[model samples]
Target: MLTKTEVVIGMTFLVLALLAISVLAVLASTCLVYPIAIDYFGIDQLTGLSRGELIKNYSVLMAYLTRPWVNDLVMPYFRASREGLIHFAEVRRLLLFSQLVAISCLAFTGFWLKRLQGLGQLHHLKRWLLNTCAILLAFCGLIACDFSRAFILFHRLFFQNNYWIFDPRFDPVILALPQGFFAWCAGLAVFYLLGQLILLYIFSIYKEGQAL
Candidate 1:
């Protein structure tokens, strides 16, 4: 049997892993997520560029986003979003590192939990963890359903300044990015979290029945 300390540690790792998954999903769904945004919401349109120009501009823009400082790039779009892009690049870098740690925690804790508990009453713990995730994901779903308000709230949390607000007069790139794009990303995160919760619930029932 797993000790109480082991159960607590393993449960903590599992919850952190789930939360990291949710964070990574939404962040990885943005304009900077690469080929995912090659087309404007899956359409062939660039803000101020023609077909021949889009390929070049798109490649340069994506590359610039990866750099923390790209002052040499004389692009209007990049300059407009320069500060926000730099901040987002930093955010993405940090999230990637944290995700690695979260995965390692899940793997180590999960292996030990399985070895020590051997799928015995530990099924209850798993079910409880899943239930917790379900409740958390339910809140995410609510945010997705009312995303405009959520988006405003999210921006306020990250941005102390109004750099995120783009003007078409200066930043034509903003036209290509509709608010619906963000809502879609939020929806995906909610669905992924909810699906995991459901799968865990189903598996717990199956294992419990087998034990009986």
Candidate 2:
């Protein structure tokens, strides 16, 4: 048996878990879609570098982003200014924060699920879950509709400095990473996240069916 307060807490954790899962899915999709984006966008010709070089450099960047306590990050073919390096370091912090939130919320959700199942109250949470997904999907739709604006807004909100506005002279890596690639990443991330939410929604519905 669960108390009303426990139910409230569990539902809150469930929502946080869903949100964190969506964020992680987006980041994973962005990383996974690099090869496809490179081929699709003719990044090699754009950067005047071979595909192999591009891949190697990008791999280094990704590794640096995921790693902690890095003194300096370097690109084989491009020189990064202090501003560029600082921006990337900020991005790494954001990624680390998201990972922590997702892991913590997921652990709590696992515990909550067992309690809900024991009480046969899984279906009771489906409405809130569906509502949360709907809200997220709506926000994604808005961002997709005006991604250029959203992109700028996202930077302004997250970053206090303007280092994201890269100068090709100092940061040639920006040539390899075009705005179009980021737009594609956002689209793909939304697609992947939607799929996850759909599965979760369906599972909630199944629980509802079982309860009845």
Candidate 3:
């Protein structure tokens, strides 16, 4: 049997892994949705850029966000103020942090799971999944209710400055990327997280029943 401390540590690792995976999912969805959102929302017309130009610039932005070595964001058609650039830099750091957390927690969770399996305690994972799912569902619901406020709150929580508030005159890229696009990204992330957790929950139940 596991001690209380061991069980708590295991659950903490599981929860962190789940949250990090969700963050990664949202970032991936953000990249994938850029082109679709641009076309669907008539961003080209709004920004006075051709479809190809918009895609090219947006691609550069996404590449900068994902690649650690790319230190500067150079969009051909868009210019960013110092504050906007700083905000993007901060976003890149946050993404890298989330990726690292996901990798480390997942690796640790693997060993923890192996230990649990040896002790016939793997079924305890189901409880962790259920509780995390409930919390994530509430978060998704809150975002769905008023995403604008949630978006601002998210920036405030993650960033120490107000650099995220971009001026359209300086950062035309914000015009291409609308709040609705982010809302879609959030929805996709929630979908991915919930589906993953529910599947794990079912598999855990199956494993428990099999041992009976």
Candidate 4:
């Protein structure tokens, strides 16, 4: 049978895994972490502008993403995104920490499942993990349904100020970013997390079958 400590460690790791995946989803949507991030921040013939004008302005817009200091028009916009850039760096740190936690949890959980026998208690633990996944998926579903409201609410809960709210004239990059992409990323994160839970649950079942 698995001890209380073993079960706690496994459950704790699962929690961290969920958090890590969720963070990745946000980073991916921000296009800061994803390679395709630059693709998400461009405009073609923006309102009241011809194709040539859009292209001319887009050249500067692209600069805000890469080396903003070299461009004078978007220097202020680059400065404005500084706080958000710091937050993104912190997110990378969080992702690293969460990955470490997930690895530790997976190691302990795998050890208990493989090296040890008589883990009848793991059945209950599996059920508990399933319940936790259900709750997380439900929350993700809510966010998926009304992403704009949820996104705003999420920012309100996490961010202290309204710095995220950017004007198109100041930071066109933010305007270029679509809310739908964020919604899709959130859904993808939840699905990825659900897959992890399913894997754990299946492993428990497979182990049980082996015992029989």
lDDT of each: 0.61, 0.80, 0.84, 0.58
1-212 per-residue lDDT for model 4 (tens digits): 66678667666765775567555544445434223433443433223433454444445543443342442334322333565554434434445565566567566655655544464565685778778888887887787678889999977876667766666665454543456555656666776777777877887778777777
Best by the TM-score measure: 3
Query: What TM-score fits each model?
Result: 0.65, 0.86, 0.92, 0.63
Ranked by TM-score, top first: 3, 2, 1, 4
Clashes per candidate, residues 3 or more apart or on different chains: 0, 0, 0, 1
Task: After superposing candidate 3 on the true structure, give the runs of residues whose Cα lies further than 4 Å from its correct spot.
Answer: 209-212
Candidate number of the best lDDT: 3
**Residues 1-212, candidate 3, lDDT per residue (tens digit)?**
99999989987887788778987887767656777888889899899999889889977988888878888899899989999999999999988888898999999988987788778886778877878888888877888889999999998999999988888998888998888888887888778778878977887787778778
Model 1: lDDT equals 0.61
Residue 51 in model 2: lDDT: 79
Scored against the true structure, residue 146 in model 4 reaches a CA lDDT of 82
Give the candidate order by descending lDDT: 3, 2, 1, 4
lDDT of 2 at 61: 84
Query: Stretches of candidate 1 above 4 Å error?
Result: 1-9, 22-46, 49-81, 158-162, 206-212
**Lowest-sum lDDT 10-residue window in model 1:** 70-79
Q: Over 4 Å off in model 4, which ranges?
A: 1-9, 21-97, 104-118
Better of 1 and 2 by lDDT: 2
